[model samples]
Target: AIALSSIAWQSGMLIGPAMAGPLYAIRPDLPYIVSACLYALAGLAMLTVGPVPRTIMDRGKGPIAQIIDGMAYVGQNKLVLGVITLDLFAVFLAGSTALLPVFARDILKVGEQGLSLLASSPAAGAALVAFVFSFRPIRTNVGNKMLVSVLLFGLVTVIFGFSRILVVSMACLFVAGAADMFSVYVRQSLIQLNTPDDKRGRVSAVSLLTVSASNELGDAFSGMLAWLIGPVAAVVAGGGGAILITALWSRLFPQIGAARSFDPAEEEA
Candidate 1:
């Protein structure tokens, strides 16, 4: 199931840009129009699906109480907390993708077509890694490997920040994407496998919150930093911060480093 999910996700990543770049080249507004139509189709398809199952809901408790309980549960679970914290900080600091327009127009001197390539490079790398992992998922030293992947992600972001050549920048982003894919897969698997069945929905809510904060908040952070500092300096500093956070998280969440596998029985024993 996990492998299939990963493949589906990567397939979208692979196809979206492959289609978007040419569509964007033909017309700047075309991509948005197509995206809106696709979204409408998706919504219609979703309407055809069955209603939400009662098993996924917590009917016994008020919404506010349920939210509080979920937060408390996450706070108490060291593994989940560690994974979430690592993701939050790493993504927050390594969000150079938010500044791609600056890089494309100013740094690389590539026009819209180049911007499309730069945007797609990371997804291409991620898709490749996801495709490989779908067949041979990581089964040992999951936590340590995830941490290492984050470190690599940060390092590549730093390289991408300093790069003047378009190809070099693309290569750096590609490497960063691969590293990020490893971290994401491991973190998600750990969260899903470790959380209790009764609290799964709430835990998923928490995960969604973290993902939103990391992506949206991180974009805001990148923009603000780019305004305060130069874009190159901002990206370099963010990458450096990510690397430092990885070191700090390694100490603060030793349990994550010690975790051997995503399998519940293996984790328990």
Candidate 2:
């Protein structure tokens, strides 16, 4: 279900830019108006979802206590810790998306239309991969596949960082997006399968928090690195950092590598 939802999200991403480009050319405000309408429709659609049964917290466990418990649980679970931290540092370092404008304007010299294309390429790639996954889900060696996806993400980012040609940069971005989607699919699966139902919400909260932090902090990291060095250099170095983090995390958390699948019926890793 999560994977399918992601595919839907990616489909929206795939279509958004195509609509925006024409609307942007017609009137910049037109794109904004369309975005607002879409968001409203999304909110309305969300209301259709029925509530599911949830685990209730004990009265004795205060908010702070629950939070502390979540922290402890996350800290102790090797597979959980591995996937979460791997997501954090890999994304935190590969902040290359922060420089799309720089690449489009200064480097590629493709102007607004080119920028639109560049922005859409990754979504196109992600949407394609997700579409494939819908029909053929990955059912083996899920952990190592996650690591490999992140590694590929880093490698593509590095290529994008160095690419001067518009086509090459777009190609790299496309692959990067595909790689990121693959990793995300695996991460979400393992995290959920590994967590108990009572602990799922708590673990999910922590995972969500980590992902949110990575995106915000990642942008800041990219911007700062660009200021220190050139944008290309910053992106390139960040990609390298992501690659290094992947290798380091694999050794540190052997449990992740040993994880074979996400089958709920399975008794062991």
Candidate 3:
């Protein structure tokens, strides 16, 4: 199902821009109009979906107390905390998508079409890896593999930052995306498998919040850093920070580094 969703997403990444570029060329506002329509259609489609069944938990308290309980549980679970923390810092430091326009216009000089290609490159790489993983998932040293993947992602981002050539930049972004895909899959599996069933919703909520913070705050960080010391330096420094965070996390969360599999029983034992 994940792979299927990835395919659908990447197909849009691949096809959406190809279509949008021409529309953008004709009318810059046309793409936004089309997107709004698509969003409306999506909302309508969701209205037809069946209701989801959820497991209710008795917390014996109000919302605030329940939230506190969830936060406490996450804080106590070293592995879950570690995975979330690693992703939070790594993504926060390495996010450069927000500055792609600068690269497209100033550095790469690819213009609108090039920007579209640059934007889609990562999704394309992720889609390919997702397809491969669907058939042959990572089954050993899942934790270590995730760490290595993030390390590579940081390195690739550095390469992309320094690259002046369009092909090289696109390639770096592609490889970075592939590495990120593995890290995301591993982190999610570890968290979901290790978290208690009753606390899963809360843990998942925390995960979503972390993801949002990473992306939104990372974008702000990138823009601020770029304003302070240029886009190239900003990206390079961010990538370096990601690498540093990964090393620190490996030592701080030994359980994450030592985890061998995604199986709940193996993790528990």
- All candidates: CA RMSD (Å): 1.7, 1.7, 1.6
Candidate 2 lDDT, 4-96, residue by residue in tens: 888888888778875777788899799899899989999999999999877866668888998888878999998899999999999999978
Q: Which stretches of candidate 2 lie over 4 Å from their true place?
A: 56-59, 264-269
The residue pairs in collision within model 1 are none
Worst 10 residues of 3 by lDDT: 1-10
Candidate 1, 165-252: lDDT as tens digits: 9999999988988888888898889888888887877887898799889989999999999999989999999999999999999999
Reference-based lDDT, residue 217, model 3: 99
* Superior by TM-score: candidate 2 or candidate 3: 3
TM-score of 2: 0.94
Top TM-score: which candidate number? 3
Question: Per-residue lDDT tens digits of candidate 3, residues 115-212?
Answer: 88888788878888888887888888999999999999899999999999999999998898888878878887788888888888888899889989
Query: Each candidate: what lDDT?
Result: 0.88, 0.88, 0.87
